[model samples]
Target: MSIDQVIEQVQAVYGSWGRETTVAQMRADWDRLFGETVSPDSSQPVDADGVCAAWIDAPEIDRDRVLLYFHGGGFQVGSVRSHFDLMHRLSAAARCRVLAVDYRLAPEHIFPAALDDALSAYAWLLEQGVPATNIALAGDSAGGGLALSLLLQLREAGMALPASAAVMSAWTDMTASGESYQTRADSDPIHQRRMVLAMAGNYLGQQDASDPRVSPLFAELQGLPPLLLQVGDRETVLDDSRMFAHKAQAAGVAVQLQVYDAMIHVFQQFPQHLTQAQEAIAAVGQHLEAHWPPHSNPYNS
Candidate 1:
């Protein structure tokens, strides 16, 4: 699909935002547009200092497996509700429960704050006795970046890593040094240089943008778990995923990069309306199912 058509459809569902709006206000507007109850299952509060929200979907018969989902909003917007549909779909596909984290947004919390919350959420899951081998990590956009960042941190902390990870149009490079930043900027529907610059300024504040956690592409990529990256051909962050995939492969990490031609940023958002989006989501589901351990639960059937 053309980028223009995708943007038009998204705009119909999510109205335009002004540059002057605060992060809190933007989040409220997103909640109103996407509706507050995107997740059909009720959320259970996870006991953590930065816990914003969390939801669990258990299989009819329990499996040791689980998926930790992080939503994307440039680290400024999005909530557990914003990504509820995608989480439910992933949970059903993986045939295991999913724990979606509502991590703190940037501009308000800044660097390390979001990362700390994500790490805390994962640590809580570990405390619950979910084995690392049975767990998978997944996210879109900034959250996708966060998934990679979390993996790197976990490795540094000498913790066992998840079985696998799936990232959708991840913004891995906060430095915005990717060639696509210029080449695909005009074609990308949702993201532009101006908006990206604004988001970076808010998130980075006084911190260095080159911090590995802020830009996973710049981090040491060795010893990470297998990674599945889904990106749109026209996304401004296209090179972010591309470069990360290249470096990861060179560092001996099993990595797969799937690029949808002529698509916009995070096309997975319109699964019902766009053929490519549905295909992308289904592809991710298949990858998760294949990598996740076999489930004895009849509910998975």
Candidate 2:
């Protein structure tokens, strides 16, 4: 088996470590596995009076350019703690401070709650005098969907759009219409078909799955910022990214879709020891930096 398979097996083991395998149990195991993340340099907690966020500074630190980051946990279990290390690497490579948003999760907060928090955090950054042109948004898995949905909301509100966005393994289609959900169902190490359906049910509650805000894949994609979408060939949501990219292209959006062979969901979070993960994240950095050149930013220069 490949190293990715080994990693997936290990994660499957963790998924069963708890007594009942409840959402809480899986969360605890996931926390222990990826939550001991170290934030290099300084990290400042920002409440924005309501929205929870943290600023993970780059190794050299740049305040002018910012990346609004969202964490993935199926929209049910992740936090800044779980995605801190990934944000640190992104900040270092992008040469900007990353504002990691701690948005509300599902089954408790439901549909628009997470999206609300994300929009508020972006608004808060603008209130902080950060230029929208100097900021970008990024996330993985559920967080990736949230990031894209937020972009659509911003467009709907007639607000200034961010410079760019980078999404990793984004679950954009809540309807689960994508072919990969079946084609790669057995192959995807994480995100079982049944479990994902259950998670979606919990997140959407009485809401319609086709609501553009709920499943961004069905949303109108016009006039959004440039987008960088990366997904693993082994991802069950592979078609989620592919279909979304096609829609974005149809809408005249500049979108780059990169599919990594033999990788699993959100592999960029493993940049510490995984070569492909490192390259993927560095590509994210390159995408963002190309939009807001590192040298042009006085703080990074």
Best by lDDT: 2
How does residue 235 of candidate 2 score in lDDT? Answer: 84
TM-score of each: 0.91, 0.93
Q: Model 2 TM-score?
A: 0.93
lDDT of the candidates, in the order given: 0.82, 0.86
Give the Å error, residue 236, model 1.
0.6
- Runs in model 2 with CA error above 4 Å? 5-14, 17-19, 37-42, 293-301
Expressed as tens digits, the lDDT of each residue in 51-100 for candidate 2 is 98887886675678999999988898887777888998999888888999
Using TM-score, give the best candidate's number. Answer: 2
Q: Alpha-carbon error at 243 in model 2, in Å?
A: 0.5
Give the worst 10-residue stretch by lDDT in candidate 2. 34-43
Off by over 4 Å in 1: 1-4, 12-15, 36-42, 48-50, 58-63, 296-301
Q: After superposition, how far is residue 285 of candidate 1 from its true place, in Å?
A: 1.8
